[model samples]
Target: MAINIRNAVIQNVTGNSREELEDTIVDAVQSGEELMLPGLGVLFEIIWQNASENDKKEMLQRLAGGLAK
Candidate 1:
């Protein structure tokens, strides 16, 4: 069976308030489990898609800086 994980993750979080979403993200990160990475990737993908060019550049810069450290 082909399961669409990204869509599933999005659907699972659907209708969440800003605080709920923030709490979900914080919980996932704090869990430190490998399984959560895909969900986090889905979240990042959504953010990337909605971001403006300048926002994208800033995110890239921050990512690069983090990696350099």
Candidate 2:
């Protein structure tokens, strides 16, 4: 038998685009899921590779501060 139409849930709408994806990602980030960190870390690593020595030092300092907690 055919099923009756009922309330449905939409995960991601077709009208939703990359901007929506970014907003979802940002919301997930604020919710404290570390699953997003690896991508961000890779980006940081790429930038670090071309950064100056002083920049690396400053980056290390910031990383240390984040690690302390």
Most lDDT-accurate candidate: 1
lDDT of each: 0.97, 0.61
Model 1 steric clash pairs: none
Q: Kindly provide the TM-score of model 1 when superposed on the true structure, using C-alpha atoms.
A: 0.92
Stretches > 4 Å off in candidate 2: 1-28
List, in order, the clash count of every candidate structure. Answer: 0, 0
Overall local distance difference test of candidate 1: 0.97
lDDT tens digits by residue: candidate 1, 1-69: 999999999999999999999998999999999999999999999999999999999999999999999
**lDDT of each residue in 1-69, candidate 2, tens digit only:** 663222111223235676875675577679777865654454455578899999999989998999998
lDDT of 2 at 28: 62
Model 2 gets an lDDT of 0.61
lDDT of 1 at 7: 93
What's the TM-score of every candidate structure?
0.92, 0.47
